[model samples]
Structures are given as structure tokens and as C-alpha cells.
Target: MLRKTESSIIFIQQLGRGLRKHADKEFVTIIDFIGNYKNNYLIPIALSGDKSLNKDTIRRMMKDTSYINGVSTINFEEIAREQIYKSITNNNLTELRKLKEAYHELKNRMGHRPTMHDFITNESIDPIVIVKPHKCYYQFLKRINEDISELTSYEQQVLTMLSLEILDGKRIHEIILLELLFQNDQVAYDDYVTTLEQLNCRTDSNTLSSVIRVMDLTFFVAAQRKNYGDTPICNLKDGAFHLNDDIRRSFDTNETFKDMFLMSYYVQRKKQEPMIVALH
Candidate 1:
């Protein structure tokens, strides 16, 4: 019996079978059969990451409905956990160059990192050839300088929590709390509360407030409103807690991120309501 390969590239390779470009067709269709086996649970683990494969992990992953459509789940707790992968030798240089070019070209085309499967579907290479090199996904992203591997473990956990799967699993209040972390890193306190209330989950405001405090200790830090003697200075007046300006800038710029952020912050602050702005 032909079974599905968990490798993202494998899916892409198979899609290559009879795949053709049609500008009129906006979607590609896949037909897969989920077999009856104790080892079926492991596929979720592979799709997830290097983390342990267990019932909870798979459950959370399946919550992400944003992945592929129409895929259903079995009773994960009842299924036996089995690791079903083998070691493969690295892909030759020619193969590596192909990968680099495919990814880079996609980045240029998409204006962001290309999903592995997208590369397989679009590139005219066999999916088997892509996976033969045995490189981990994280290794490939780092090689191309599009970084996700550098994320702190806390960030990864938050990402997992805020992912479409887990967010879809939780209550509306919980979803609002996580959405605070969308495109912008920081937001205002009132906006957090207001967004949560949009769904009429009024019971969560106090709890959500507490969760923000906990997230500050572990996943993020907050900037408090402060004072210089009697004068009010830089502080969060219900603003969102985020990676300080410096850290945020450091991710993209080489100039001392923290220092630059501070300088810029002060410059902008002074200019905002100033009759005259200067620094000594």
C-alpha cells in the first residue's frame, strides 16, 4: 500500500505528479488516505517540530485550522507513539545550490520566506531530491539568513499558543489576549481590554490582565509609567509591553539597537510637544 510521507517536501514532490501551472486555478487539490495504524500519531510530531510527540502536542496542532483544509483527526491518545524516520545522507552541492536558489527566488517573489511545500510545488524538482539531503528546516532558514531558529524558547511557546491552531481551540477571550501580539510587538492596555470585550467575554478582563503580568515575567517585559521627581517622563500609559525599542531595532539594524532606540525615543519625545528641542 502506498502511504504518505510526513516530509513537507515529499508532499510537494507528489504534488508535482501531474502538476501544471494554470493562472486560472487558484488552488491545488490533494487526496490522501489516513491508514489504520498505531504509528499514525507521529505524523503530527513531524509536522510540529523536534518537540516530543504526545497527545497534547497533536491536539494543539490540529486546532490550527489554518493549515490544510478538510484533514480530520483520530483519537491521538489511543494511538501509540512511534518515530518513523531514518537517517539520510546530505544532499550533494548541486542539490544544495538548487535549494538555495529556489528559496531565494521565492523570497524575492513572495517578499517573505517561502513555505517549504511552496518551493516543491513551484520548483521543477522532484520532492525526493529536496529531502534526500537530510537538513533540518531550521538549519535551512538560518543558512538563507531568514531567521526563526534564533527565537527564545519562550517566544516559540507564545508562537505556538498564538498560532491559528491553538487560538482556534481556546475561548474568544483567550484569542483576544493572544492577538495582542500580531504585527506590532507592543499595544495599549485599554486596547487589549477593549478587543477582548468585542466578543462579549467580559469575564476575562481581570484574568487577562493577570496573564499579561505572567507573560511579562517569562515571554515579554513591560515598560511602566514613571516620573523624574515631579515631572512625567517616558512611560507606558496603558500602552502595550514589548521588546524595548533597542531590541526591536537590533533585529533589523546593526547600530547599537538599545542605544539607538533610546536616542530616537528621546528625540521624538522632545519634538512631540516642544517649543524648542535640544540635547546636551
Candidate 2:
């Protein structure tokens, strides 16, 4: 039940098995099955890239990329939360601290980060010790900046709207344009005043025009104008607005959106909203 320095050998072994050339083989297909299939810090680690051991490198790689699905890490469910908490607290961190150190050493020594369950299985500790209570092991990861943070509420909402915009191709621009006005990111004129009036926001045409100008510096949306130098909302040529090409491209493959979606899903299971306990 205890085998230190075996993970690295297994890692190399698996790849070596598939890497053997054959006429029937098209290419080497490496599939790492993992329960905690989330986050991107391990991308460079998997490829054995430069700065693979550096947390900054991982964060930079994560941010610059489209998305991360942690295929190499195993995620454990909370089973004996109370028992784990009790064990560590009663021990006064002597054993806990040692395990934490081992976790780091194992990562470097094993050539890959090992899961808490993996540690429990390979070491003389209870699997439930780090499996259940989140922080016992979380603090260890935080020391190394290997912890994955959850998403915020506003960011999640933005992603929802963005995803909807993508699915609703015909109305994406029109929907977001209306959303700009709804969010007060854009201004409307006489007809817009009518829209605001419908919303019970009391404002005259000139005041609305001024407000629109003040808030029109949108990064993802642009308003159309009439040839007569006036904002138009009724005429397709003058009133319709469009989404920026670059912003749309970013939305197509944004890691932030994917992270938020997963975090929201996780939180929803607990009956508490995601951002109620956001990561930073």
C-alpha cells in the first residue's frame, strides 16, 4: 500500500507503452483519465515545458490559453470531512505538517503533483485525512500557489449572456445592444427615452442623449449612426449596433467563461450560489 517514487515510473511507463512505433498506429494518443478534470497549470507540466515547476509559469500559461481541463489530476469527494478534521486538529499539525512537506517533495520527486488520496494510499496516513476537509490540504497547495480559485458572480452572468449571444446568432448584436442600454452602458434617444420610460426611468431625450455619449465607450459593442449625424434605433442602417470581431473571437475560447461555468455547477450542487464563496 506504500510505494514512493513509483508514480514517475508509471508516468514514463504509460507513455513508453504507447510510444512504441507500429504500422497499424497512426500517432501516439495519450489519454490521462482524471476526476478533477479542471484547471490549466499542469499544461506545461504535461509537456515538460520550460518553467514547468514554477507557479508563475503555470498561471501565465493558464491566462494566455483558451481553457484547461485537468486530465492528469484525480479529484476526491468529501466523505469523512469530520474525521479528517478531527485527526489533524488532535495531532496539532505534527503529522499534518510532515504530510504537507511530503506533498511538495513528492511533486518534485515523482515528477508530477500527486492527489491527497494518492498520498494517503502511498503513505501511512488515512485517505480521508486530506480527502474530506478541504483546507487541511488546501493550505499546503496555497503555500505553493497550486490552488484553483472559483469564479465570481458578475463574471458568471457575463458568461451566461455571452454564451446566449453566441447561440442566438441573428439577435446577438441586437440583444447585446439592448443589454448595453439595459446596463446603462449605452444611451438611446427619443425611442430610447421611450424604452427607459417603459422601464419607469424618467429621463428626457436630451438628457438621455448626453447619458448615452458618456457611457458609449463600450469595448464589445458599437452603435450605428444616421447619415444626418444622429443615433438611430429603428432604421437598420442607423439604429442597429454590432459586436466587435475581436471580442467575439475571445468569447469563442475564453478560459474564464469555462471556469465560471464549472464553478457555478459545483456551487449549485451545494444549494449555495457560486460567487457566495468566490476565489479572490
Query: Which is the leading candidate under lDDT?
Result: 1
Model 1 Cα lDDT, one tens digit per residue, 37-148: 3334445544444222223434555555243444433232322222221111121323566567756766788787654344434543322233324223333455557655
The backbone clash count of each candidate, in order, is 6, 4
RMSD of each: 15.0, 19.7
Candidate 2 per-residue lDDT, tens place, 1-280, comes to 1112223344455656766879997675455433232322232334343321333333344334433344333222233223323332343323446456656666776677664434433543332333223322333355557755433343333433332222222211233234443334234344554554554444655654444342233223442122111222212124533333333333446654444333222222222223223421
